[model samples]
Target chain A: MKFKAFLTDNGISLLEKRFLPALDKMGKICHLYLTRDHAFFLHNLLNGDGIQSIAQFRKEALFDDYRISSQNEDRIAFAVDLSLLHRALRSVVTIYAEFGADGGAAAVPPSNRLQIKLVKKLPPHSQQAMPFLTFETKGYKSAVIQDVPISKPLSRTDVLELQAALDSAQDLPQTLVQVPDMNQLQTFVDRMKHVGDPISMSISKCGDLHLQISTTLITLGAEFRKLLVIGEKAQVPAEDRNLTAQSRSERAILRGDAMSVQVSVKHFSKSLQCHLAKPDCAFYGIAPQGACLTVIFQFFIPGTHQTDKSISLHCRLPVLDPGSG
Target chain B: MSSEVDAESADLECELDNVQGMVDALSSVRWKRHQDAVIELSEHGIVLVVEESSCVQAKVYLQKELFVRYEYSAQARVRFGVSLGLFVDSLNTFSRPAHSSTIEIRYPGPDMQLLLRSVDSLDACIYAEIRTRIPETISWDYNFEPAGSTPLSFTVKSAALKEAIDDLEWPGSSIQVSLQPAPPVVTFRGEGHGDLQIDFMYYANTDLLTAFHCDREESHRYKYKFLRATTSNIPSSVIKENRGSKLTIGRGGMLKVQHLVSVAKQSNSHSHADSAGYLQPSRIAYIEFFVKPEVDDDNAND
Candidate 1:
């Protein structure tokens, strides 16, 4: 298996500064799935709730130039510690900052590509060996190589099951609402984070969103109006598009017909921390009957037309049992 | 002794219009745990000294100019040891920006409790009393004067310093800092999983350093953990003021970092006779951290 990519400084910065930090908060280890067209950082997020968050960096969105050659046609996956990779990227960025971008030393020739190589190395006197991901950049006379060890990839059954879940989730009737900005959403969630457990969120057909938390003593909530509704054309399948169109006309009379989801306040707030990286636009997707909720953040490289780079955090919250609580 | 005790009973009381100015300064040294901080109150100002492990000490001084009313009895000074955490929390209770709070601090005598009362504009008041004990007088003579004719001194933009430090690869337990005069280079070196060296040359990047002076080449290795006590404060300091902070290194390997606290303008103005004539641009608080270099026997000769 071989994978090499010429990643731009901006692309690397987004992953190091924005993408990885959010993943670090969710889980320790993640499977980095590298295909011909994309690099996926898949985290199970076993935050005790068994939620999964996938950060998909399309090849066009990540690398200025790249290539991936593997024996099999399927994507090659490997597990790596998110924190370790973050540190490695930080080190690489630091080197670039200190020594001019061309690599500070005069002996090494300048190269545009920050090469990443995965190699299996057997150290001296070691009985077992594992693969290590090495980040190397050569400039003028200076060169830096940061090697981070990787763990065995997740089981094929687990990967397939996760993919199936994502695929099945797309067909669920979702109420998509455009979040005005991350700051406002973060503030609303932050205030409710400490109020109580199992925050209840409802998005009306008229584009009004309400977040509320109630305890035995107090019930606190906030209402946000005029939230933009994401049309069904983009997300709904072609056959179901007509059905949604028909329902839209009928739902106009029933303004309060809203989709609602109840999720743990602690887990909900932890997911909001990812917004600190500052995504350009965010969308909230709630599954019907309060099954699950998804937050999709869109990020783009500055001065670039590539807008496909995005991260979606999927939270699996149990439908609040009426008698259990 | 009886007259002295009577005089102490009538000691001075301190009052300020805003508690945020005091809380912001104390939060910088909140890293120390279970350590008693001595608060010295006088007519001139209030001084808070926090000592940790007998090796590192931090002092935050709020001058009388920053306070609205400063009064003192006939006594010279009143010093007491209080829990820094509790004191800081009491001040922080009224730290909201929207509400204006007036803080009154009073000490009756040696064994009397320290009373801190905060009253907000909404007629809400919070009263907190902390038991005060006689502060242990430890004579710590820190000579600000340099041992050599010209000590290593430089003023760099806080943003640049913070960025440079954040960018350094902290690979080892200690970081080696080198300041040289000939080439005017400031380099930091660390070793752990790998050897990492970062250098800043005056000629290369002139914008980062405003002033650089060194008589001879001086390099010292300090415990990275100790130096980290001030790392988190750098970003906040730079955000407050564009003007950089000053760093001074003495021959004894002691490092002094001075940060000017940014004071928010008072929205509610009281035209008192005392502060009416004082037309200072703004109140400024200074936080100084003094870190003693760890002795590395291997590098002692070098």
Candidate 2:
């Protein structure tokens, strides 16, 4: 006989105080997904943060074979953010769980034991079926599981054609690889595998291995890291929510004549400096706090005689403000 | 002998050369009309003659001073009278002639010394001596301060001008001016040894018939002022009449002609001025001449 466990008000209160805080401190919380099996499994490991964890939980729930076999139908629900699925390879794996949208369904017994198996496989770069895994495994129920199937035409064919042309060109462009001396390194680890063996490859001048290998490793490692990230569910920290501030100072006019201008500066870093034309008047002035700095000067009008009457002076204040970060 | 020839040529050049009078003199040579002090060149020297309307000549010699003070404490007065000695000296030396030239003149100005001079040679010679003496008291007592961090600047200012003109009491003549083949246009061309020369005739007006002789028979004076003439669209023919005409041929009506051989033979219209019943003005253009009897040497010296 199947039993029912109703969460009492007192139980709920206790859970909020105890479990919720624990989840908050760990930076991750548990998620519930509906399944035809009406059973649940504790799947996908996560650090305290709930962001990266929920992704893993959704994948596990979607590909659970026991649930698929028990119900012999499609009953999978989509995760909140599908971008988390950017890290899958060959076929997606999942763990099944049970959930009831109605009270009557809750009366059923929990589904089979928790298991992991490939629920669906995807073609190479088959973007049309993205976020939806479609397959024809005999033991399974439906071949597809997703909130919505993709409706746009996939660009994989065009990409393949372009790639072919690129590959056959005689003077194929190549990216040179820069290798660094790795003998001195104590430890190096990469979640993604590329050209070099993970164990003995040397670091290059760019602190990387061969170009293609390094690029692939970086790309794949980013995806793996993303998958790991999605496994967690969390809220933003106080530090992140804090407001950042930036400021700017005023400009002061120093001197002006028929042909040139001198500006006074108080306090600034690289943004504030004199700009003058070449081959005109040479400038020397002061900067920072006190008077005396290098002045940038140029001839106001070229080839005009050096006579005072021939000179003209112009002065303008530049906008001085720190841009928003 | 070529040097002698060149010297002779130089003398001939001196006689024929167009003398440029003082900077501010009779703007145009007019007969029977008297200017204040018309600077003129003579075989003797540069002269500034005083006529009936001689107020400007006296005003120009006062160093542009409105008044003067005897002492720093004294009130500046309207100087009604002031004496200044103006004399000519040799260009080679700053020495004045034994006898100083002086004239009694009145004006509303300050009492100050003014000097003037003239040179014999035109091209290289300066027209007049320009001199000013900074008094020892104020010479080094002041300094200038520039607007910014720049140093001060100093400049010396002076002018060259005529002190007097030849006697201006000569009698008025009936000066008649007209343009031949009047109006629309008159064109001429001329060539000198060096640069090209052009002459044009502008209009003229006069009050010659209104002149009256001064009561003093010995004095060359009149109770009249010279009237100014207005000019517009001046033509060369009028210029030729105004100044006596010179050698310049002008072709007004058109004519055509052709030169060179045509192997197969071709016909063409000849466009020569004479053949076309038209006359071309001589290449050397307009000139203006008017009778101006020489002032008596003794009267001019006076």
Candidate 3:
């Protein structure tokens, strides 16, 4: 199996500036799954927290050339230390910032190509070695190559499970809530972090959103009215599609009825950190009566009105028991 | 408990065009060792006091006239203690440099929670309700009256004092502030690694020192950490249209630093003169930091 890609400067900067910080919070080890269509970086935290995070980069927007060859039908997956990768990316960004496109080298033209190659190497004594991610570029004076050591690829079963989760989440019963402004919600969650553990969010059919956090000393809540709730539009199985339509219409009938879910305030706030990127528009994909919450931040290329790219952060928090505080 | 509270609950509310000004002031003192603060609401205005390590205290006073609308119960004073971190975080959510957010605060009654609503330039509103507890009544009877006929007091530009404080050498536990009347000079002495002294002669730099008064040579040593907490507000105050920071050395070795901060003015009200039109910023908001001197046995005789 092999995977290679030429990443764009904007794509690499976004990964370094926005995505890496959130991934760092999940775990140090991550699996990079690359395919012709997309590239996914997954981190399943082993801190006994069962926390998993993934960042998906679309092939067209992220890379100039994407290629993958594998014996199996699925994409190729390799595990590597994300911290080391982040450090390498930071150095690349620093060099790019210090020396612009030209770098004042007329003899040797500066290359925008940050070529990434994954290949297997054999050591002096070892019969075989895992694939290493090698980053190379031709600078003004000379060529520089950096090698990042990789670990054993994720087990086939683990990769399948992650892919299944991502696929299943697409057809789940979801209500899209447009976040007109994130500052208020950000502040509300920030304050709730200090006083409570589990935060309950309730969205009514009338587009009223309520976030409540209760402790022994205080029970605070903020109500947001008139948030647009787009009905489920994703393709679902024939039978489930009918059921989803019926439930959505029923919700429309009861204006005050709301679907509420309780999530760890800390985890939810961590997911909200994507707002730091200042995306043009933000929306939440909340599964009905489920602990899984997906926050998608959409960013458009400057000078263009198209929003064809986005970074989605998913969070699965424990549901609080009704009897517990 | 008071009958007037019932009447006030019906219509008691205060509004401000901008919330960033107060957030900046509170942040200056929020870094102290105290995690909580007491907010006292009276007919005069709102007073937030943060007491740190039982040795230092900072108070930000927003007078009644500072608010676009101020209403208080005529019966009794309303006071409560809240987590300073939470309060500051909630207020900061609406703070942006490009645009100022409007804030409306209401204290309905003793039983009801305090309500705060902030609306940003985009018309995004954040409504926060903070629970309050009865503030602990502490005896703060430090007399600030000068001991002699002439008090050791001076008015200095906030930017100048902030720069001097920032330039002081670290690893020093105490900052010795000395005031002299003969030549009108103010000196800051930090004794760490070596003795570092910074003096501002009133005669040499008249623009730096706006006013100076001293009867005798008096010097007081205060914990450098406590004094450092007050310097954070200097930068914000110095950028205001009307900016000046006053330092007064009161009796019992109490240090008081005061700044008059200009808050948001009404966008439509542009008079520029007393008789030309309606005036903006009818009153000024001031934040003061009070620090108690440390009693050092080594310097007691000196």
* Highest TM-score scorer: 3
Worst-scoring 10-residue span by lDDT in model 1 chain B: B1-10
Model 2, runs deviating above 4 Å:
A1-325, B1-302
TM-score on B-chain, cand. 1: 0.83
Clashing pairs in 3: none
A107-188 in candidate 1: lDDT tens per residue? 2334535777777777568987778888877544566888888975445665565556545644434556667656645654
Identify the superior model by DockQ, candidate 1 or candidate 2: 1
Per-residue lDDT of model 2, residues A215-316, tens digit only: 211111100000111111233233322211000000001111001112212211110111111223322222222111122223333357452222211112
C-alpha lDDT (0 to 100) for residue A114 of candidate 1: 74
lDDT by residue (B1-302, candidate 2, tens digit) is 01112122111012101111111112222222222222222222222222222211111211111111111111332221111111211111221122111111111112121212122222111111122232222111112122223211111010000000011112232111111323211112212223221222222211211111111111121121221111111222222222221111112101100001001101135422222111212111111111111234454412
Best by lDDT: 3
Query: Candidates sorted by TM-score, descending order?
Result: 3, 1, 2
lDDT of candidate 3 vs native? 0.66
Of the pair 1 and 3, which is ahead by DockQ? 3
Q: Is candidate 2 or candidate 3 better by lDDT?
A: 3
- Against the hidden true structure, what lDDT does model 1 obtain? 0.64
Structural similarity to truth (TM-score) of each candidate? 0.48, 0.12, 0.77
Please provide, for model 3 over B85-189, each residue's C-alpha lDDT reduced to its tens digit, 9 standing for 90 to 100. Answer: 667766665455445567878775355666676644322345556677777775443445665677779988887887778767474878899999888899999
